[model samples]
Target: MHGSTPIRASRTLKKSHANFYRAFHDYFVTHLPSSSLHPDSRSSSGPHHQLPRSASKPHTPGEGPSPAPLLGGTRDTTVVRIPLRSAKHHFGVSVSRGTRPYNEDTYQAGVIEVPAFAKPRPLNLTRAPANSPLEAYRAKQREEQEKDSGDGEGTSAESASGDPQVFYFGVFDGHGGSECSDYLRETLHETIEETARKYDLVSTLKGKPQTAAIVSSSSSKEAAKDTAGSATEPAKGSMPEPSISKASTLQNNLLNSWKTTVGGYFRRFKPTAFASPPETPTTSTVLTHAFLQEDLSFLLAQLRLSTHDTDPVRSDAPLNANDSLYSPTHFPSSDPQVKKSFKGGSTASIALLSTPTPTPFWHPSTPSTLYTAHCGDTRILLSRVSDGAAVPLTTNHHPSTPSESERLRRWAASFVTDSFGEERMSGLANTRAFGDMSSKRMGVSAEPEIRRIDLNPSEYAFMVLVSDGVTGSVGDQEIVDLVKESKTPEIGAREVVGFANEVSVEGDNATALVVRLGGWERRSEGGGGGMGTREAREWRKREAVDPRGRMT
Candidate 1:
């Protein structure tokens, strides 16, 4: 009777195990589609038979049940029956047209491959002519390119180590129409790269005082000779000078002498006279401002030219379309009728991350850097995993801000209060943007506020670039939390977009780009202990009270 009792207990245990397996199988089948299951398992007749091949084999009494069958089989044994998704389509973008008739928001995020030859290098002006600043500038640029090419790190290094990748992300918000935003989405990065390269060359030339002095002296000498010749030759019906004015010549010689003296003193005292100084944001900021302003001006000019050609009435009409033909002061129309051509303008917010390569000149302590240029309401936020904080890296340029409001008032721009009590710059919510030629006269600028942040791999976690649509609906803490919780940047971006669409305000478009930084692995390494630190708690408390305070 005792032997029979042991047998009955064993049978009961087996039954319980089978029941548990059946319940798990049923839940898996109900929740996960057949496509998510292995093909062999899908064909099995019952829950027991649906077990993986490894589980089908018998297990010894002392050994644990052969590792429980996974929801999906191992990669080698099982094929992923699900269709593959492209990284560009999946990881790159997740956007939603919210309540707006059309999505006026445009965004771009991608890895840009930079060739070894394209890397920035110091220009050598050693062989540049002592005179002719423009010639010296050209020579310096040529020498820099030649030096870069001579480094012998082009194709071989690129093939072995792969091209250095620069991750670029941007969001453009269009107010009146999508044309300007669309245009910017396609060309802004290229414009920035071009502007930066030009600025680098110009800044390098400006840094060399000796070369500049030489050029300036040459220019002064040439001016003096021209003045003397003009005075001697005399203009038609003009009186000739009694003696060739030596004053201008004498001043040029004295200026040259002073410059030479100063140059020699600096060269003798400063050991690193030729070394390039540490980079600053001033040059980049100025370049960004100039590029944006010039691009907008070019767009306006093109519109005007096109309008002048297309409109026969304007072409044949007098200079001032509003003035009568008999008006005495009538002049040819210099400005184009671009207000009608461009109905809307866009706000541009761009972020660029440059990762250093393993070159001979590369410094081990020098970290990757992030550059941001913004002109509108879109935002860039940095999350440092060490502190568990969301740091706003941009300020929204709107008339609601005191500084912007003051600038608009100085420009004599008409302002109206909206339903939300926000001041509008000539009926536009944003004070700075590209296009909107009509509002430009009222001081609507396209000059971007550029910033640079050095990325420390130990502290940096991720960056978020988003349009106002997302910001309007989501708080900074919430965004950081969502991204922190996500397993991957692609998933994080999708989740953020989904959340924004779910709770976004009416008549807005939502877009988000999540960039995972260098120290993402540190989060997993810390096992959540990092987030529990005192500094992290403090950061969270501060964020809760005022998320937008530091940002504004």
Candidate 2:
């Protein structure tokens, strides 16, 4: 009788959920345009009754149709919401608890808009007199300016007035516990922005010339060379003594010209030190490493402060009435009593999609470039219609990797593989991660591998960021094919998580983030699978040997 009662309750809950879904769907369908509705809802003879040829047929796994052309040949394509069964495009996300008591996987996706007014303006330097000692210097200055401008064309007023949007997505997988992953989800982006701002300021300062000093030195050297070279061969009508005076005069003129130029450049550029710069530029991998290190240090300091008292009650005291003693901020990194509480660590994988500045003229509609930074085993995969396959954007970082295993051995850390056949470093599978203070002394690093890829809007389809929970159970190609078969990104994400849960025996938390790279378009026809397979393989091989290349 008790079992029957629970079964009846489950049926009732399912029915209620179904009713709610149906009501929401009906409300949503009513808001869409009449033409976007199902054919039965629109008259057969209506002007917009016919569906696009690509949408008419159902897409099979790994058989995505060619993408439809971008409306008006630009990224400003219209997004039409349709019924779930007919939906063809939408960004989606899925987070599943799987069989874990607590889910430690987290993902985020959103657009960041940067206004044109926020962009840096070029400096205007004073022109030097023709044939003056400073003429070569002026030529060099012009060359530098041109190179900085890229393509010698400044941003147009129209482009400057418009706001460019960038999409960012990331996946974080926590081990031991979810504290570190949750903390990163809240603060990593801001930290990256701060680091980028510092880098930009340093770059700007380094680029600026000590105009007067440089010009004076160069002018003096050139004048002395001329004086020495001309001494042996005096011109037919020129006075030899006057030539020396002329060289001195030329040096003086160059110095004066440089002073004026420097004044003008500074006045026009107004290069003031910014307290903060906008977060658009790709962040250096070192910044990621430094940020994690600093944050961990700060946490450790705070924890030390909170637990300095030797008294059991005082040392374990909570920060507030509602807060727990084991909260990330209060839990001491070194305290053995709370090791289980504070030992949690997490892996971070971030993908930043940013619009290039001085937007390329040839491809004015160029898609945003993708920059990725990862530590641990979470993966990023790019699906390209041109390739018709999934391409791995990041390699997993675990003890299984030769580099990681060698590093662990060098550190002399003791660990044993579990029943799952996974190698561990001081009981941690990931060789690099954030907040593994217990293993930090054992050589687990916070450094991340970074990579950059220019996305072509025409051929790019979508990108997936997933935790190992998904990759452990599903193949890269299978994930790509599943996404291709789904009508929209959201559905694709849900399907991926669902598949991972079904296949994974370990019951780890599963999370997937699917980001559409371009506007809704039908998949192209007759494209070969895996366009950059060879290049990707070569890149992985090279990176394994030297993971620190170009990181900073």
Candidate 3:
């Protein structure tokens, strides 16, 4: 009876949601001001002078059949600095971790299944403010780089020759106005990359490759437990082959992985944190060594520096997070309260590409990198154009994953539960995301499950990244099809966004960014565009567009 009730309620919920979408789609936007096309102020940031399109003429790397509507609207914020250490340790390690604004009302959705060949990566890195000096430097470098790599030289298609090419693209799906998505749009990729570099994950992965350790640890732990009994011997009829790496008794669930590594990163350990203003404890060098006994010497050393302790709540200052979004920390400051008086957040996915490394048994052609990160349903879809089929790139993280929920179940240990004494379950809320910090214990995960993947140059057409606005109502497969089917990725992207918006309507701010091989063209000489006669600028200023341009 209880199960039946939930099933009925789910159906009703779906019906209501469908109705809402239908109504929203039918209602054409009214009062769509140029300012609506432009941006309003931000809770955490200042306004921008102009959009990217305004600063430079777009030299589309990939072109397609049509140029649909362009998504506009944005806000800018101060440059964010993510610890280089964290990013490297947690490559493809999920959460584009941040100090998210604490809030309630929020919305997000999308699908993600990492490319089989590629491991999951936290698609996040630190970002510079829209117009900061660092931003200026980076932008200048890109212009020079693009000119050298993309100028009329016929080799545009393979611009990424052997050397690492920094590519930028993002899908910012906004719900309550384009604020959150726009913030992400302006700052997502740079943040992800910077964060990734910090952790120096390439070294971390090599030091403790997740796979070999799991196989060895499980074999050791379970073998000890089963020595007396419960060891299901190999079927006499089918003897097991002699492979050095045997699939042990461990369940292929994410939780088991936690018992060894992941859980430690999330929880507070006795690290040597630097002292605050209050009476700081002076730690003698000898005492610190004892604390470092458990391969956590580095961590303990850090703690001593800061009066370290577990329980993030007890900290004098909050766990270090993005500088701009610094509301959640426990520290008291003279800094004026951030004017951003709104409650909102976003579900984001981030990743980093790495150089190939050698593995014990497997001969991988590409870098065995980590994608430690969290995300909304907004997924990362990877494709290898040579095969002509889109491939899954990372596991879709949601409240639905039993393993993810299990981690939370353990976390809820001290809290009271049902009459039957079962631990309370906060499973339905997404297990990981960026903006849903208010729902941290329930709706979000502070830690991200870093997955690994290899990038193979031989078989990739590039990746297509989008937010829920683009994929929620529209099928994920359809978006991939659009990208692959189109002649070039730019048109493919524009068409994909247009179609997605057409299906979901204005309420869902949809955006698509494609970073792929080329068919790039030089910027159109800024002049009277759109055929010989009616100038493009005059047409917009006077609503006097001529249909004659459509003729030729």
Candidate 4:
């Protein structure tokens, strides 16, 4: 009888697991908005074209139901699979078109390889040249590459070991159409890597205190004089250093140091210097430049095509119509005029995790750095396993913000309010986005706000990047909590998307990308799955109104 009890317990556990999944499947199919399930129900002409029935299977209400399979069971066919090259890094992505006829959300995740010759110059008190940092870095990289190829040596940094690797993840939310997002999905990361190689090629101030500041050659004399005059007192007219408390954590100390170093190296120097201090190239600057340049390029290509239709010379030119830039059929057109013009825009939230190679220049105990570049409302959140805290790394860029509103006002851009009372800049919700040629002239810029964080593996578990579809409906902490108890990152991403689909009234296209960091697989005590999720609460409320429809 004792042996039989053990067998019966194992069977019961399996049955319960199966039942839970069955219930989820039933709820998902039943609650799915009718517009998504029935193609004819949606308008034939609109920004969102109806997806083919073959794109996804729609389970009609009251029809025969079955347990959803693991991978193939999802309705949307737009799920992105990670490449085998990036498999070493644990990550997962889930993308689906909910109530919309087509999915405009897209994501990219993989490893980016920085050039082996890329290394930051050693820190020195002496002022550097006035040349652009990007130009100088490129010239040096070219010379170093030639020398390395001849001698078969790596980076010039003394005792340097291997090349640094960057784990790159990005999610793009498209409005107007998916063309812009699709183009960004294919090209944005490449542009970032190219820009990083030219501008942020080196790891600056590694293995040393970040107190040293790089100064301009012209301000060297005044800077030295000010430094000699004051240990505690400020010079006649100079920016004062921001105070740092001893009680602050190491992370906070590093952050303050970075701000002091980058904000103004000549903090104690006199006023009447040249114009302003030369900008120092860093990851943030690199990302900002990449976003702006990419946006400009996308807009230029779109505008050129839009005007080329009326240009007789362009029509008769020998250019290849199949070329990516010239091809009108490359992406679905959202324009009503059927012109070859590309009319779409997208919001981007990108996170790059940079880990130094095993080199003497970098300390063995040094933590990886996370650099996030954000434009528009897509979100990036970091989950700390130590205390189960959710930290948002990017701020949403909307016209409603004071700074954004003021900036738009300066450009003489008019604002419009949607039926939902949401303010928009020239008919677009986001004040910053990519490839909206029309809005570009109306103060809609692609300049991304950048944030830097020193990632402590033991303290941080994972990072999640989601499109506005998920963020619009789920709270940051709730999203992190939902993933906390998942068995794997892939399952967590699916659950987040599923929950967002259920909560959203318009059925927006949803996407979630989870990257497992050092603290992944480690969970804070007393944290796991339960019935306390937002979806569960909503379900309970619905059940209260219809007791007969309740699930056992």
Highest lDDT: give the candidate number. 4
Which numbered prediction scores highest in TM-score against the true structure?
4
lDDT of 3 by residue, 362-464 (tens): 1123333323233445666655444344555445455345555554555554333456444333422344444332344332442333333444333444456
lDDT of 2 at 430: 84
Off by over 4 Å in 1: 1-91, 111-163, 200-286, 305-340, 358-366, 523-552
Better of 2 and 3 by TM-score: 2
Ranking by TM-score: 4, 2, 1, 3
For model 4, residues 1-552, the per-residue Cα lDDT tens digits are: 775665566566656644432211101111123355445654775324343444335544332222112121234422112232233335667888998999999888654544222223333455447597856765565566446533222321221222443556789999988888887877777677666545433343232111123221113455333222212322223223322221123223323432343223112222211112312333444465567667756765676577778999788875554443354324323221223567778999887665443221122233566667788999999887656778897777788887677766766446788999999876788888887666665567676765556654356777899998998877887788777767677887888898787766677999998777667656444244322355664674476456476545
Q: Which stretches of candidate 4 lie over 4 Å from their true place?
A: 1-89, 115-162, 205-276, 311-320, 323-340, 358-366, 526-552
What C-alpha lDDT do the candidate models reach, one value each?
0.51, 0.51, 0.33, 0.57
Cα shift from native, residue 40, model 1 (Å): 18
Count residue pairs with overlapping backbones in model 2: 10
TM-score of each: 0.52, 0.54, 0.38, 0.59
248-282 per-residue lDDT for model 2 (tens digits): 34334433432343222212211011101212122
TM-score of 4: 0.59
Candidate 1's residue-wise lDDT over 1-552, tens digit each? 775665566566656644432211100001123333443754456344233443222323222111112222233322111111122212335688887788888887653322221223333545646688867766565465445434321211222123234456778888787867877776565555443333332221112111111010012344222211211122233222222133233223333532343232212221111112212212243334344434445455556555667777766875555432333233323232332355578888877555333221112332455667777789988777566777887788888776567756756446889898887866788887887666665666665665555565456667788888888867876676666667766787887787766654453788888766665544334325234343543464565457485467
Better of 1 and 2 by TM-score: 2
lDDT-wise, the better of 1 and 3 is 1
Q: Any idea what lDDT model 4 has? A: 0.57
